[model samples]
Target chain A: MSSSTPHALAESLCILTLKSGIWVLFPITVVMIMVGILRHYIVLMLQSPPKKQPRAAIREQRALIRSQIIRATSANSPIPPTYYKSISQHLSQAFADGTYLKDGPPKGDAPAPTAPNPLTDPAAMDGMMAGMKTQMVMMVPQMVIMGWINFFFQGFVLIKLPFPLTLGFKSMLQRGVETPDMDVRWVSSLSWYFLNFFGLNGLYRLILGGENSADSSRDMTTPFAAAANIAQPGQAQDFNKLFKAERDNLEFAEGLYSWVGKDVDTRILKKYGRLPGEVPR
Target chain B: MDLTTSLQKLAAYRPKQSQKSKETFEKGVALLEHGGYLKQGDEGWDALERLALAALDQDNLEVADRCLELIAERFPGSPRVDCLIGIRMEATESPDVVLKYYDELLEADSSNAAAWRRKVSVLRKMGKVDRAVEELSALLDTFYTDVEGWLELADLYASCSQYVPILLISDAQNLMSARYTYALQSLSHALLLAPQNPSHFLQFAETAYLAGDITLSLKMFLTVVDMTDDDDGDVSPSDSIPTGMTLRAWFGVKLCTRRLLTEPRLLTSSGSQTPAPSSSNISTLDDLSTERLRTAYLDIKNESPPATEKELIAVLATLIK
Candidate 1:
C-alpha cells in the first residue's frame, strides 16, 4: 500500500496522515449523539405507565417479587435457614392456596390456562406494545443514521484507537477503504460514527442526568437481553406456572438449612468501624 | 443564660477535632441546676441532650448518669427520655440487657420514633444488623415518611449487599432485566422520600460510582460537593451520616472525575450496559450542573484523597498536568 512509503516507515510512529475523514468525525459524532438523544426522548414518550391492576394481581406480583428479593437477599441475609424455610412454606402455601390470585378456579377442570386467555389479555398486550415501541425506537434511528453515514461519508480513515487490535478488525472497521496492508488503526467515518453511537451514553449522562431517556447506555437490546417477555395482550400471567417455578426453586434452595448467620460485610464493617485502617494518621 | 448558651454551642461544636473541656459541660449542668432551667421544655431538653452528649464524650459516665436522671425526672412521659435512657443503658448495662430494656420501652409506646431509632442504634452497635434492618423496616411500615428510617435501612442494605444472580433461565427475555442491586433500591427509596438528604446523596454517589454509573455518580458526588460547600459554616445538619460516608463520597468524587475525563469517548462507546433507572431519584434527576461538577472537580483534584482510594491516588498523581 502507498501508506508504507520508505520515508514514512523511517518515522516508525503509529500516527499516520489522513484526509477529510478527520473533519467527518464531528458530523458522525453529532449524528450518533443526536440519534442517542432522540432515542431516549422517543422511549420516554412511548413508555406506558404501569396500569392499575386488581388488588389480587398486585398482591400476587408483590409476593413473587418478595420471594425473588429474598432469594437475592439470602446471599447476605442474616435470617437463618429456618427463617427462609418458614418463609418458603408460607409462600408455597399461599401460592398453593391461590389466596392472592384475582381469578378463581373454574367450575371444574384444573383452575385455568384462564378465561379471556392470557394470550389475549389487555395487560399482556400493553407489555408487548411497550416492547415493540422500544424496538422501533432503537431500530428506526439505527437504520436511518446508518444509511446516512454510508451515503455521505463512505471512505477515509479517522483517528487511531489507543488500544491495538488484530488485523482481522481492519476489514470490519475500514470497510469502504481498499488499501490492503493499511494500518488497522485507520477506521473509516462510518465505523467511527458506530463507535460513538454505542459509546456516548456516559457523556450524555454528564450533560443530561443518567435517567434521561436519550442516554442510549442501554445499547442494543438483544432478544436475549430483554428483561421482561412482552406477551400478546391477551396472555395473562399464569400464576400456576409461577407457582411451579417457585416450587422448583424452593426445592433447590438452601432455605431448608435453617441456621442464622451474620452478614459478612456487616461483621467486617463492625470490626473496622470506618473504612478499615482509615483512622486519621 | 451563659451556661445554657455554652451547652448549645458544645452540642453543635462537638464535631470539631479538638476535644471539649469537661468544665464547659460541668458548668452547664451546674448552671441548669442553679437557675432551675432543668424543667421540661425546649431549653431543658436541649441542655440535657447537650450535657448528656458532652459528658459521654468526656467519658464522665457519672455525669451522664446524673444528666439522664434529671431528664427522666422532669420529662416523666417524654419519648426523648426513653432515648436518653437507651443511651445511658449503652454506657452502663450489657447490650443484651439494654436491648431488652429498649424492647420493653418499645412495647409500651410503639409510636415513639425516637425509641425505635435508639433501638436500631443499639442493634447496630451490637452488630445485629439483620435485626437492625428488620426494625428499620418495621419503622418504615408504620411510619413510611420517616426519612431517617429509610436512610438507615438503605445503609444497612448497602453494607449487607452481595450480588447474587437469579436463575431467570425460563425465558431469555427475563435475562435482559438486570437485577437491581438491593442497596441501590433502598437508597433510591430514601432519596424519593427525602430528596434533601446530603448524606444519601453521598451514598448514592459512592454506590453509583461503584456500580459503574460514572455520569450519575459524578452528578451525585458533585451534588454533595455543592451542598457541603454551600453550607460551609457548621458541621452539616446531616447528623444521620457517619464520617465514613463523607470519606467515601469525597473519594468517589476524585475517582469518578478522573474516569469521566480519561476515556470520555471510550467509556461512552464501550458496550457496557448501565442498569435501567428503576429508581425515581434518577428519573427526577434533571438540570445537573455540569459547570459546577467540572470546576469543583478541578478544585478537589488538588487535595489529598483518603488512603482507601489508593488506586485513584496513583491515577491522580499521573493525571493530565
Candidate 2:
C-alpha cells in the first residue's frame, strides 16, 4: 500500500540512508560495552575460591588424578611397567579397603560405578552453583538489551549487510519488523545487535584474553560448566571399579622398552654400530 | 664373558669413571635375601622378580629357584610368575619348547604384555622375521601407544634390508641400518606419539638424518643436543648423560652443520619449503655451527652447565621471538 500512497511519497521511499548506520552502530556498541562491564563485575561477585579440602582428602583426590593421568598417558615413557603395576595394585587395594570412601559400601551386588546421590555432595552443589552463576552472567545482559531494542526500535530496519542471505533466515533477520516483502539482506535492529554479540568474539579475545568468562556464547564451554556436567547430581562412580578398569588397561600397556627388558642398551648399541651381543664379551 | 667382567667393562665404557667390585652385586643380593620384602605386597613381588632374574643371569640356580618359589607362593596366579617361568625356560629349554610354552601362556592370557614380549623376542631369535612382524603387529593392534613395539617393528624392517647378526658388534654396521627408508614411516609415528623422552629425540634425529629429512632431523637433533645438557639438580643424576651421548650428538650436529651450509634449501623441494624454514636454520649461524655445539658440550662436561628442563625450554621458546 505504501508503494502506491502518493501523498506520503518521501516517507514511502523506505530507503534507509547510509547515515542511519551510525544510529544502529551507536546502540550496538553501547550494548556490547555495557554487557562486557556487567559481565566482569557479576562474574567477580559470583566467584568463590574452590573449597579447601583436608590433607587426607587432598591426597585422595590427587591419587585419583594421578591414576587418571597414568591411564591417559600410559604410552608416555614416564610410567614404566614397575610404576604401572605398583600404582594400580596399591590403588586397587586402597579402593577395596574403602580408605577414602565417604560412606560404607552400599547394599547391592556389584555396586554401580557412581554413588546414588551426588546431588547431596557439597562439592557437586558448589559446581552446580558456579555453573548457574556463569549462565546468569551470560544470559541476563543479552536479554535486557534485547528487550530495550524491542521497546524502542521495534519497526526500524537498521542496515543491510554487504553479503546476501537466503530467505530461510527471514524469520530470524526481520524478527520484530514484520516486513513481509523486505529483502533478507536488510537486517532489523534486534538482529544487528545479535550479529555483534556473536561476531565480536575475536575483539573480546583481543581485549579480554582467550579465556574470559564474560563471553556468554562460550557458556557451555567454560571449565566450570564442564566440571559441573561431569559431577552430575546423584551420580558418583565406584573407585573400586575405576581401579579395576585402570589395572586392566595398564596390564596391557606396552612398556616401550619392556620387550627386550635388559637388552635396551644392547639394542641401542646394535642400532648405532655396536655388537649385537654383550659389549666386552 | 663372565658377568662380573662384563659389568666391569660396561662401567668402564660409561662416561662415569666409577669402578665396580664383585662385592656390590653380592650386597644387592643380600638386601633382597632379607625377609623385609616379604611383608610388602607390590614391592615384594618386584623385588622377587629382580632377584630371580639376576640369579638366573648369574647361573645361581639355588637363589633363582628360591626367589621363584617365593613368588609362586606369594602370588599364586600372577602372569608375572608365569613370565619368570618363561625366562627360566628360555635359559634352559630348546627354542621350540620355549615357543610352545609362550604360546600356551598367550592362550591363557593374551593381554599379558610380558608373555607377548617374550614371544616376539623368541620369534626374532629364531629368525622368523615375518612371523615376528605379524605377532608384533597383533601386539601393537591392542597397544599402539607403546614406543618399544614401534622401535622393534622398525628394527625388523631394518633387519630385512641387510641383517648380518654378527655385524651388530661392529661400528661400521651403522651404514647398513641407515638405508632402510621403510622404517621412516614407523619412526614418524614414534616421533608423533613420543612423550617427554629426550632420548627419543636423539634417536629420531639420527633416523631422520638417515631418511634425508634434513630440516626435521636438524630440528630434532638440535633439540636432543640441547636437552642432554640438562642438569640443575632438578633432574635426577641417574638421567644424566655421559660423554658418549654428547659425542654422538656432536657427530649429528657436525654433519648437519656441514650439510646445511653446503646444501641448497630451496632446491630440495618446491615452493612448500620456502614459506617455512626450520627454526634452527633461522637461528644465528653461530648457534647452528659445529664449533658452538662442541664448545657447549665441553662446557657441559667441564663447568657443569646450569641447564634445567625449564632453562633450555626458555632458550628454545625465544628462538624466534
Candidate 3:
C-alpha cells in the first residue's frame, strides 16, 4: 500500500475501534447489571423450601404438641391466645397461651460449609456468592446515581425561573431603587418586612421538609485547650463563697416567701432590722 | 352627823319634812363631805339623800330616778345629784351611754382626768376606738407630763397595731415601761427610714428582741453580727427591759443560735465558743408581745416539710425564745 493510504486507513481503524468499544461493552454491561438486579428481586420474593412429611407424621405431631403444651403450661398467666385451625396442631398448643419455644439447636445449627464442596450443596452456595458479588459491584454506582438525581431534583424544585432573559428584568427590579436620587425609602424599608414575612415561612418549610441529607458526626474533642499552665491557689474560693451565700439566701427567701407573701422579705427585714440601702456614715 | 343616826333622823322626818327641804339638807352635807348622807344647810335634805341611797341599794331604778329628780329640783346648783345621776346612768345604760355621761362629767370638770380615763375605757368597750384615741389625745395634750396618760395612750396605739405611733408616743413620753412595743415599732420604722445605719438599725431590732418579737430579734441580731465590725463596742439599752433582757444581748443570743446551728462557720467567728447550743435553750417567751412571735413561729412550723411534732416544737422554741 502507498504511504498516504496506509495513514488514512490507520486513522479510520482508530475511529472504528473507539466506536465499537463504546457500542459493544457499555450496552452489554448495562444490560447485565439490569438483569442481575431483576434476578435478585425475583429470588428474594420466591424462595421457600419444599416440605417433606415423614411416614410417622401423626406421631411426630403428637410429640411436638406435648412439648408445646409443656411450654404453654409454664407461660405467663392472664391471657389465652385465640385459636386458628390452619396452623399445625403442635403450633396450636404453643399458640394457646402465646408461648413459643424457638426451634433449632441451642448452640446454633452446624457450622456453615467450610468450603464449596459438592457434598454440601455447592450450587446453592455458588448462587449466593454470585448474588453477594453482584450486590457489592452495584452498590457504588447506585449510590452515585442516587446522589446525582437527588441533587438535581432538589435544585430544580429550589431554583425555578421563567427564562434566562427574565433574570435581567428581575435584577433590575431588585436594584432599581439603588440608583441615586430616587426616593426608594419605602421600597427599601418595606422590603425587609415583606421578605421576612415570607422568608420565615420558606425557612420553616425547609426545616419540616422531608430529610435527605447525610448523617452528622459528633466532634470528639476536649473542651479546654491544654496550654494555659498558670494556676491560682484560691481562684474560685471567693466566687464559690459568694455563690453559696447568695444561693442559700435565695433558698431561704423562697421558703419564707412561700409561707408568707413577701413575709420572708419582712422576716429578713426584721432580722436585719435595717434596709440594704442604709450605709452608716 | 353620824351616818346611821342621820339616816334614822331622815327616815323619821320624811313624813314631816317637804321633799325640797330634805334635798337641801343632803346638798349642804354633800358639799362638805362629797359622799355624805345629807346636806346640813337645808330642809328635808337628810330624808331625800337617805332615800336616794336606799333606792340605789335596793336597785329600785324608778325610786332612784324619783329621788334624783327631787334632789335636782330642790337643789338646782348642787352637783351631788348630777354625780348620782351619772352613777345611775352608767349602771343602767350600755357602755356607749355610760361613755356619754362620763364625757359630760369631764366637760363639767375639766380637771377630772379620772372621768376622762373612765370615758376612754367606755369608748373602747363600745368599739369607738377613734373616740377613745381622741380622749387619750386630749389627756396627752393637756397633761403632757402625766406618765399615766402616756402609758394609756401607748396601750391604745399598741392594741390597734399602730406601732410607729406607739413608738413615737412612747419616745415622746420617755416611758421606758413600753420598751417592747416601742422598740419593735421604732426598729421596724427605722429600718424602713434608715436601712443603711447598721448600728442604729440593730438597736431597734435589739429592742424588738427585748420586746419579744423573736423573728425580728433574730433578724436584727444576725444583721448586727453581719454588719458590725469585730471591734465594735457594745451598745446596750439604757432603760433595761423589765424582763431582765437587753435587746442587744437577746439579739446576740438569737444570732449566735442561728449561726452555730445553721452555719458552722459562724460558730467559729466567736472563737472558743462551741457550736453546741448554750447551757440552756431560750426559756419561756413570757413577754406580753410574745404571742405574736409564737403565732409567727407556729405558722412557719406548719410550712416546714413533714417533721415530727417534737421537731416542730424545737423549731418553735428557737423562734419564741
TM-score of each: 0.38, 0.41, 0.22
Write model 3 residue lDDT over B1-321, tens digit each, in one string.
Answer: 653334223322212345554564445434534534344445456556656655555555676676677678776744355555655675579876777776676566665545555566667666777777776666543433333444455456555533334434545323432535543432332332234456554554455444434444443453443344332334221111212123333335444344334564443332112122222222111221233233344455555332443453456455546
TM-score of predicted model 1? 0.38
Writing each residue's lDDT as its tens digit, candidate 1 over B81-200 gives: 666666666776898898888788767755555666677777777788778777777665445445556656666665653222455334433232222234555665565455556777
- What tens-digit string does per-residue lDDT give for candidate 3 at A1-281? 46556546544544454444344333333433453344345444443332333222222223333223223322221101111111223334333322321221123454532333432554444444444443443344434533543343221111112334333343222232233322221122122222332233333335433331111110002212111111121122222223233333333322322111112223232333233453322
lDDT (tens digit, per residue) of candidate 2 on B223-315: 555555544545432234334454456456556545665675622532112121333333332243333443444455465333553343334
Per-model RMSD to reference? 27.7, 25.1, 41.7
lDDT of 2 at B102: 84
Candidates arranged by TM-score, highest first = 2, 1, 3
Q: Please tell me which predicted candidate would have the highest lDDT against the true structure.
A: 2
Q: iRMS of every model, one decimal?
A: 17.3, 16.2, 39.8
Considering every candidate listed, which one attains the maximal TM-score?
2
Which residue runs does candidate 1 get wrong by more than 4 Å?
A1-281, B1-27, B30-36, B39-42, B161-180, B197-199, B219-254, B257-321
RMSD of 2: 25.1
- Model 2's TM-score against the true structure: 0.41
User: On residues A170-270, what C-alpha lDDT tens digit does candidate 1 reach at each position?
Assistant: 87777776767667766777777667766787888887686775644364645423325555333556776687677656555544332222222222222
